[model samples]
Target: MSDRPSPGPDVVVVGAGAVGATIAYTALVRGSARRVALHDIDAAKLEAEVLDISHGLSFTPRGSIVGSDDVEVCRGARVVVVTAGAKQKPGQTRMDLAGSTVALVRTLMPRLLEVAPDATYVMVTNPVDVVTTAALRLTGLPSRQLFGSGTVLDSSRLRHAISRRVGVAVQNVHAYVVGEHGDTEFPLWSSASLGGVPVRDWSRGHGGRLDEAELAEIADEVVHAAYRIIAGKGATNYAVALACCQIVESVLRDERRVLPVSTLLEGEYGVSGVCLSVPTVVGADGAVERLAVPMSDDEQHRLRLSAASIRATLEAVGD
Candidate 1:
């Protein structure tokens, strides 16, 4: 028999809960990774999830899925997506879970990093900005190699809202939600567009014109969409899992897709030392570059406010 060791998994999802399991399934089905490993503390849940997904392998692109309670399952992963944290209850803000989530990350991140030090880490636990900042401070990995799945989902929500209002395909609605992923997040309407037309200039055809007031309402809905989903269902998994898979695919495929992901800012837009979502280029190296997208002065101010909000949570968690 050959003595060569088998290569590690292409992706490692830490946490086998709703979000994590969905991410693992999405990655495999999308062909983002050929082998995905799931690591969680709960052995029964992990085992059940692995088996359930494994049963569906015949329908998906050729891939292998494995799970274990040990962090060793994460060893040699090229990309590690973290979704482990306290689940958010209805009426609770993402910041409300910060203390417990950040604490969990503090204890969990080092173990994952120890096994997959070279893996590009994507933090998805909410208050994601705070958790990401804590992870960066604790691990000291370069910012590009580690970032939060920030406003990527939020931006998708924003685009979807705009699409419905304008009666266009969501894929054609190009907009972004930047800043914190929580209550402080806001849309970059100044740069928003629908089918190459600036959003503000778009006139109604079948749908209503997106005027200033309607835009404001849309932004509010995007910010609270998660709460509405959480109130109805215990958690949001589908879209978020898809978003995480998009990041994983971009990294493994080196797609260099532009996404609004959270990374530590070093004087970008005059905000420094805080993790918040801004339009950034994500690829094999992780959040490789931050884009200086044009933003109205008001939008810039709001982004700073979002940064302050995340910084407060970081301090509260002793980061």
Candidate 2:
């Protein structure tokens, strides 16, 4: 195993569960970082996960993987991705898992800061927006330095659903799922485009492919995608791990990519004091700036409603 030495790991994944392990593995394979460290309270699980991934090092890029129950493993990390939290169950919403997850983050974030104060922290736990808000309050870190994985995964799911419905490549379907990454999340259909054409205007002679009914169905699918996955499997990991890895890449490489990540809103979209997903520029410094993308009246209202939902949860959790 690689020992923690000077010029510590490029990325540190906190937690050694399926999601955490996958983030570590993905970062290594994508060359997102040279040294990836993992930490979990479960010593046995951490060791096994580290060994399992380390065994396949030859198949991946030249990188080092390490793990420990000690938070010291996270020291000097350029980016720390937290995927440790209570697992969501089949019938429960993300909010249902919030209280326990927030409590865990409350205890975990301080220790993380002690080891890697300057590291950009990404919260990948459930009800991530709330957990992120709590972390921000608990750590007093700049919003740019601490944020949530947010709806980056939700946006991907939205784009995939749109692409499938419109028979286009998912990459070309530019859409975003904004607001809370939970039941209240909604799509920014006003700005969505498919193959360089507005989604609302897409037509193949007869009628629009993304009519009102189809759009509603697609939105529902995107919002409930996680529940469906969890009902099938015990947890949803791979897609979210990839999404978290994208955020890590943007940070470690200073890519300055625009992503719909959750950040604390300070009057943007008339919402403040809550963390929710909005299109923001992410780079080495973290969520640097949020874009004031145009939204239709209905879309704006929906965003406000989403904000309200998150605010209520924050109040309930006493954050």
Candidate 3:
């Protein structure tokens, strides 16, 4: 409708840490953009990551890469992923890092706003739920435009774990770990299935077995997987970066994938005015709609409890 040429850099990933760097590189690998800009305050890390990724560019279908600290790189980006923040400690929860990360986003958003006002802001920092909420408030961006890379990875892990226990392909297992993204998180078992078959019923008919207790144990493992990975690797970055790349691809290509990502809730599941994970439609316009998955009474109550916990974390971060 306009005379201006359409943009090509479909995504720009900020921060260049483990997560941000991986997402930028993954975008190139998937051929989701004409260009994928990688930015960060850490010049050395940015160069190293770019150099590492550049070596593989010859193998990829196609894409350009750039590393800079300039906010200008964000211009014309269809999606901007924020993955810059403090790393997590062994025993701490995601929300434990909220205060510092929230402040950091506050300082960064105004500068980013100047460059990427039209870009979808996909947050990936730890304590992502609270940091995302804070970003939305700070930028005054539309709810859909500002959301977190919420529990999608956790959900993927849940499905994978269940598949292993049930002897099914991971894709055949549709499950979600939704909520605060940490200890307060819970799986939406009521809506879970394998090839459209209810997991519980399938297990019972197959003489397979999993009780509430077992499911809880699986969830605990899913929730703490990052911590364990961090303890071993010094950071939990690549998986989340890949997750962000998935979200960016979906949005840039208008795929409309329903993923569990953190979005501001306004009366969904009887929880209002908080940011947390739920099944959502991510497409060219960012979060186009929230896919309301029916929850059992206990699931709903637990989700609300998780929301309350996130709200408390937001408060602790000075809201």
Candidate 4:
């Protein structure tokens, strides 16, 4: 069973932390998956969260919400989302939790595969691309069946910010925040358009002008937004949880949506042997393929740098 399980029971979410709880909730309420299971190392905490969400069962949707400390509940799960990692602290980058989470992933991946060997793994852990690349190397899982949430949230944030700045609907603002999910991530502005018109053209035609400096500031805000949220609430969960659900829906429904997710790269735009955010087709089989989206010279260079940074991080972690 090396393929994605047909959508059904046991879309297991590892880690009953704030993010994981929200994911299970979203999947059920939104009908992304019928059975939402959560697992955590903390037995008591896991039970508490499960009960908390399960209480809303009658109000939200017709589905089962259960959790366990045992990982085997994940056996034969259609989708396994790995959110089991050290929570990011205030002022800490996602990569900062990598060292602490490495041992967790190492111990968890094998046991998980033992039970749910064919489950499509969606890595939602911190330092997502690095962790995903490491998981791939550790388990030797098919690249298609393994990937990270990557810049989907970051891109969402950028879209929101851009729409706010341009006075347009967020849904109509077509933009992407690509590359790293961290400080070095970039906004794909060259290809950004509003309803098929270039952003600059739209602005100019509408008697508005947002200079490059302003756009850069917007992109900076997108990259650092997570840190700010973490500082305020101790963790950023709501939006990321939704992002995890987005990926889950695409995989379970075989939507074949083109999303900016973290997947392995093999010389796409001169990047190889790294898992970083790129436009990819994700569906029943996980990240099915990377799309050859055109990139500007600067964007390509930045992407290459992002790849190198992730590669370096993976190597330092002994991947």
**Per-model TM-score on C-alpha atoms:** 0.98, 0.97, 0.95, 0.95
- Candidate 3 matches the true fold with a TM-score of 0.95
Candidate 3 vs candidate 4: the TM-score winner is: 4
For model 4, state the Cα shift of residue 60 in Å. 1.5
lDDT by residue (246-282, candidate 3, tens digit) is: 8888988889999898999999999988888999998
Provide C-alpha RMSD values for all models, in order: 0.9, 2.2, 2.4, 3.3
Q: 128-242, model 1: which lDDT tens digit per residue?
A: 9999999999999999999999999999999999887778999999999999999999999888888888999898774668888999999999999999999999999999999
Q: What TM-score would you give candidate 1 relative to the actual structure?
A: 0.98
- lDDT of each prediction vs. the true structure? 0.92, 0.91, 0.85, 0.86
Where in model 4 is the C-alpha error above 4 Å? 1-10, 204-207
User: In angstroms, how far off is 32's CA in candidate 2?
Assistant: 1.5
Worst 10 residues of 2 by lDDT: 203-212
| Over 4 Å off, model 3 | 1-8, 204-207
What is candidate 4's lDDT per residue for 56-87, written digit by digit as tens? Answer: 88887688977888876787898999999888
**Weakest ten-residue segment in model 3 by summed lDDT:** 200-209
For candidate 2, write residues 1-319 as lDDT tens digits: 7796589889999988888999998888888888999999999999999999999899988999999999999998899999899888889999998889999988999899998999999999889999999999999999999999999999999999887776788889899999999999999999999878899899966234678899999999999988898899888888988898899999988999999999999998789999999999999889999999999888889999999999999899888
User: Which residue runs does candidate 2 get wrong by more than 4 Å?
Assistant: 1-5, 205-208
